[model samples]
Target: MELALIRHGQTDWNLDERVQGRTDIPLNETGREQARTAAELIRADGADWDLILSSPLQRARETAEIIAEATAVPFGGVVDGLIEQNFGEGEGMVVAEFYDRWPNRDFPGGEHDDELGARGVRTLDEIVGAHPSGTRVLAVSHGSLIRGTIARLMRTPYKQVPRLDNTSISLFAHDEDWRVVTIGGVSVAEAIPTTV
Candidate 1:
């Protein structure tokens, strides 16, 4: 199985550096353009995608729609357990301020790290098992969820996994063992720091 994990495009919350966990924020205009560019890149690569799945969030769904339209890949139904981690009262808080205030934990009622890891792993493993052998899939998800999923798959700390940019593709290849071909659509050997 060859899985392409894409982060959803930018939103107003992203531009404002707000914590958008579980907030149904829509994509900004620039986000649509970014999605189009990402779709073009995938098309140029000649990826023969068998499925295109996305988080149910409006932003991720829209981005997936754009990719599906651009690549002519049939968009798959929304997969459960791929939503962003809930931040509770921190949803609209500025990221920096939220971190400063919490220092150690998320907002009250927010999800825990263990829960993040379990959900990410269970959902992805289910995806891998449910799809046919040698399936080539594209899954559009949130930044934190993608990061948590990657960390769980690699058996590393979530913070150790490099952050992915908006519309960036992370390839997960499953052979006898599952491994990552790329972290953000580029060889993991070459690193870049980017934000949505």
Candidate 2:
């Protein structure tokens, strides 16, 4: 299966730099526009996704819905394990504040990196197991989860993880082994690139 993992569009919380973990915040106007632009790029690229999976969070759901409309594919089921890493007491706090509270990046009463990484890897692995090979799938998820999952799948250390942009598409193919086709590929309003 070829999986396209996308981070949700921008939310008010995102603009405000607040930690949004399972907060269900809706996307801002700019975010909606971003999704639409991404959708157009996907269409232009001729990326025909057979499945459109998403996290239950409103941000991810809305972005996935837009992509489904643009790609002309049915929106697939929401997977629980795809949800963002819990921020716990860090929710609504500034990004800097989170670091200040927990220098090691763990939110109080929230999930740790190892567990989050495992969840991300497990969720995609389950999907891959349930589906046949060569299935084109798009999954709308969060930044941290996407990064963690990709890192886990690649077996890379924390320092090697790359930051993902909103609506940025990362492609990975799982035949016998997982191969990263691209990472942090953006969708522009102009002509879409043929390759990811």
The candidate maximizing TM-score is 1
lDDT of 2 by residue, 1-196 (tens): 8998889999999898888988889999989999999899888988668889999999999999998887788898799989999978888899888878887786678887788889988888888987777788999999989777766776665435666778998877787777666667733212123222
Range of the 10 consecutive residues with the lowest summed lDDT in candidate 1: 187-196
Runs in model 1 lying further than 4 Å from the true structure: 191-196
Model 2 misplaced regions, further than 4 Å: 186-196
Highest lDDT against the true fold, candidate: 1
Error of 1 at 186 (Å): 2.9
Q: What local lDDT does model 1 show for residue 64?
A: 96
Residue lDDT tens for model 1, 1-23: 88888999999999999989889
Global Cα RMSD, each model: 3.3, 4.9
